[model samples]
Target chain A: MSSFFLFVLTTLTVLMLVYLYRVVRGPTAFDRVLGLNGISTKAIVLLVVIGTTFDRVDMFVDISTGYALLNLVGALAIAKFLEERGEERQ
Target chain B: MTFEFPLLVLLIMTAAGAIVVKDLISAVFILGSYSFALALVWALLGAVDVAFVEAVVGAGLATVFFLLTLFRMAEKDTQIRRPPVPWIAFVALPLLAILLLYGAGDLPAFGDPLSPASTHISPEYLENSVEQTRTPNTVTAVLMDYRALDTLVETIVIFTAGIACALILRRGT
Candidate 1:
């Protein structure tokens, strides 16, 4: 509620935008992956804040947890799959 | 004016960023972030039950699946290119969002006490569901029981997504 929190949130949005730009414009495969991972971690915090704002703490918490799991698993799977392919050709 | 604006702004920003990004991996991550932001917004709005579901499925499992597909997709060729023009997604998305927002105008106000959500069957479920179903949250009871058939179908859908992903990856291998 305080201006300080607002400032922090605003700063996050700005940072997120910067990252998005990289993901969109990056010329390589890995760079985009890195950018996306960064964005996802930031999102966890954002979700809780939204829940608090709306007084939907109970529902949002569960959703946040699920989202966290999805990001983690999805990242690892992609990483593993890519690694395996690279190894096979070599 | 307070928390909701911050939350909504975050969600839209992430959503826009996800679609506009060209790098598939980055786009996936943005999607995850978008999901997380949406979950947080859900929690803040007193939809803890919904938040819990979204957090687990959308943020957790969905991200994992996306990464899996991305990894499987990486081939001998390493170059990833933009689709010549991503400006289109940016322009078109806002228009879609506005149209959706207009549709949303018919919906009830956020957390409106007198809304159907607070009245109708919800109140009854809230009051007696704990004792009747041995569940602390009526929402869970409703999801698990009252809507048992639909939930079963949804579970099947999740399973199908996993299977389909595996099948697709297997083919490339």
Candidate 2:
């Protein structure tokens, strides 16, 4: 089970790298934001997987919960900022 | 341990991307990714509490604050011109990296049970934390009980900073 979790972790990290490439090379700011959001989602899952590896899911769950809430708030704040600035959706 | 290298590479890449990006918004987003990668690195190193703080402050609040600052700036100011590579950076960066690597070489291996910290007060804290503080989490007991005043002062500092920000933003608008 632990090895399986490690495998999953490797795959997620690879996917995260791909998203990071999009963030760096994307043509538009929106693409960068999308990539960041994708990375945050993956990070939350990564936290849980790490907790599983540590055999301390309960402890890490609390942190991941706080992380998810804050991630949402941050994304919403950015979206509102962009909308208010009237950035073109490209 | 297998995932650790890739995550560290991700951290380096995100940091470099943040620096190289010309758009301020892209830089801010890349910084957010950097924070997430750093938090993961902290977790991988068995520093769950530190990871939590990094996730909240670095990835969350810091990103929001950067965006707020960008929002207040003129749009034209957000697209920075690429500056010429500084000769000083070429000289200083390699020297700094070498110095840091030299320092790191003397540090104990990760999770070394016989390391100074592990051999010293850590064992005492681990053994007695639950009995004294009724907290299963030793890190929590240490932070909230053994070093309560330090934590309280940190909280107060953050609260004060929040109030100051509110005042400044209010005055601006």
Candidate 3:
């Protein structure tokens, strides 16, 4: 059962790497943001994996909740920055 | 050991691949994948609580937020090749990696009987953790009860990160 979870986790990581490649090599700034968003989602799952590893979930639950909040704020901030940049270009 | 070895190898390969990938968006996803792999390894090591946090933070919200940011970014020419950063930073990273790997050398085996972690608190917790806290999950008990102040402090730090991001974005205008 644990091994199955590990395999699933690995496959997800591989998928995330593909996304990261898009972020790093993609021509557009928007692509990178997309990749970053993918990474954050992966992080949440990663947190769950951690909680499972230690057999205690409350700490990780709080951390994951906090992480989600941070990720949302960060995305908004980046979007705002890019929008401002676009305006500046005009 | 068989299970652990393959996972570690996969982790190293993906990390290397993420660094070498030229596409920015792909790179971000690769980072996500790296985090996922890490979470798996964390779980196999018997740190279920940490694994849970990693899965939620590393695989879920972080990836979504990153994509949202990407959506608002301006398009650029693809012919520009890889993004540039200082070579010195790249050089320094390997040294850090080597140090981290070196630190792992002396550690106990995964799930081994004599691990310091297993020996450290299990006996005590087995005896008193449930009795004192009335919780079946010892890890949760420890976090919410035995060391709640620390957890609260950590939460505040996360809150501060949010505030900092808001200030940086808002004040720039």
Quote each prediction's TM-score.
Answer: 0.68, 0.93, 0.56
| TM-score winner, 2 or 3 | 2
lDDT of candidate 3 over B19-89, digit per residue (tens): 77654455555666566567667665655567656756665556555655554565563123755788898
Model 3 / residue A36 / CA error / Å: 12
Off by over 4 Å in 3: A1-90, B65-105, B167-173
The best candidate in terms of lDDT: 2
Summarize candidate 2's per-residue lDDT along B1-173 as a digit string, tens digits: 57788888898999999998888988988999999999889877767778888888898888888888988888889998986998999999999999999999999997899999999999999999999999878888998899999999999999999899889878988
* Root-mean-square deviation of every model: 4.9, 2.0, 6.6
- Candidate 2: list runs displaced more than 4 Å: A87-90
Task: Estimate candidate 1's RMSD in Å.
Answer: 4.9
- What's the lDDT for candidate 1? 0.68
Pick by DockQ: 2 or 3, better one: 2
Local distance difference test, each candidate:
0.68, 0.88, 0.67
Tell me how each candidate scores on DockQ against the true complex. Answer: 0.41, 0.80, 0.17
